[model samples]
Target chain A: MSTEPPALSADRRREVRRQALSVGAATGAYGISFGALSVASGLSVWQTQALSLLLFSGGSQFAVVGVLGAGGSGVAAVLTSTLLGVRNGLYALQTSRFLGVTGVRRLAAAQITIDESTAVGVAQPERPAQRIGFWLTGIAVFIGWNVMTLVGALVGNAIGDPRTYGLDAAAAAAFAALLWPRLRSGDAAATAVLAVFVALVTSPLLPPGVPVILAALAAVVVGLRRGGRHEAPPTSRAGELPGADPVP
Target chain B: MTTWTTVLLACAAAYALKLAGYLVPATWVEGERRSRVIALLPVALLAGLVTVQTVVGDGGSLVLDARAAALAVAVGLLLLRANFLVVVAGAALTAGLLRAVGWG
Candidate 1:
């Protein structure tokens, strides 16, 4: 693929930005849930906001709050969250080459190099629109998520005990929902089941983080055992934004 | 680690992860085994998290409480193909109702 960005007509550019803004609005609003849930999990509003501002990865942000909420240590939360965010690293591979950005701009691109941006970027038929879509979506989600996180945290804090709103189970529920998409594959489902068993067996005798760590080791074993098998390396990422191109 | 420490450390590490993506050679992560492990890691980690959060209590013992019911409800929604947010809300409502009925 040529690295040079192709020119786009005005109409297409407008359409792309429009789509970006709309998706950004919707995604930003979803930050309210993370904010509320994080607060419910006992993070202060600012702390919740920090997760949004700094980490900037959606599922990973949820993982951090969820892990900590369930009394898992920081190490566990970080490790789990890191695993969740690794896909962005993969996305970054395509993104860095495509964007051809460098210096401070490259660094900025890295900060906003999330699933939403990458998907938006990759989905565009034309190269110019791809760049625009990437930036617009990233900026939109960034502003939207951070601002709404503060709003949600305040509202959640006002609600007193999160359990009243069933927020106590937010982490598990969210993670379960996240897991659903992976269940489409038999290999993934089996890994999940076995991991659950590992988690359950270890929960009785281990620290909060250790069980999850042990469970992750199951994947390491599976990955190594199946390493030589032909599986497609992912070209896209896990960002499930509306209207983004479906990754093959 | 304290929550503050956790937040700071996590933020730094996360940024590093992203930065590493830019700096690390594609060939390293491009290998079949490494990519496979990367893809599967989240599955195992999240499954464990979901299991622990739903079934394991603070004392680190299995406890089938409101959380368990909530997860079951969420699974039902998932089976029905509900949207992600809807699944979360459904779980919350189910757990809340169960707790209110004093069944949990």
Candidate 2:
């Protein structure tokens, strides 16, 4: 991966900036729902707010809420969420190649090396704009998301008995929305269905949360059986484009 | 509370995972069959989560509750390619409305 792509003309720079801000705004506004939902899931305002600040990965954050909201053990919730965050490791591999970052800067890049930043960075044809896009989107989303998290938390704090308004259904709905796009291939669908079956069968016998962890075994089994189809060629399938993972 | 302790430890663990991805040599993690399994975990986890949230409840058994109906609505909206916000609001509305009618 080359670090010096090419010079960015004035138009290209402006175009990159606009793209960065737009991605930032969209991803940032999403933070509001996460903040609200985390609180709605029974996390304290401070704790919810702290999660946004610390964990910062939207999908993992949502997994945490979804599991705990259902009375899951902390271990199950954390393990499930951590499993989802593994993709970040892949994104990091991609980012480290082209970003050419080193020392503390590289470490910081690792910290914010999420989907949007990696996507924006990789999308750029020019090296400078790539770095710029990555940092711009990353920092912008960070500021916007944290601020909106406060707003959503305050709003969530005002609501009562989330169950009364059917807000308790939120965790389930969010998961369904997230799962919709991932069922692209027969294997993925089968894995998902099998996971569902495993959880359902185990739900009665196992304690809360354990079944969800057990369900993850479905993917491991299927992935092993599926063999070498590592990443579906980006164009060949429509399933795994961004925003499919329900961040909220 | 114990929850906070778990939250804190989880946060640290999550951060450690992120950092380790950077610190570990690429050869060890890249192109391994194990990576494929890790990649698919989110899809599996999310599907399991949907099942739990929709059918399973605090009692740890499957039940056809308002959450299930709302999830059906969400599935419909998502298949229609509705925006994320709309999907979320629609599901919440469906559940809220059903509960208002005493089904929840």
Best by TM-score: 2
Q: Which pairs of residues have clashing backbones in candidate 2?
A: none
Residue-level lDDT of model 2, residues A1-248, one tens digit each, is: 64456678999899889887877787778777777788888899888877777777877888888778888888888888888778777677766767777788876776677777777777787778888888887777777778888888888789877777676776677677667767666667878988999999999888878888899999888878845554555453442335324342
Q: What is the TM-score of chain A alone in each candidate?
A: 0.87, 0.89
User: Tens-digit lDDT track for model 1 on A1-248?
Assistant: 75565578889989999988877886787787788899998899889989999988877888788888888899988887887777778788877766778799888888888877887888877767888988898899889988888998999999888987788886788888767666544556667988999999999998787798789886777677753433433343464543231110
TM-score for each of the candidates: 0.91, 0.92
Off by over 4 Å in 1: A1-4, A227-248
- Candidate 2 Cα lDDT to native: 0.77
Candidates' lDDT values, in order? 0.80, 0.77
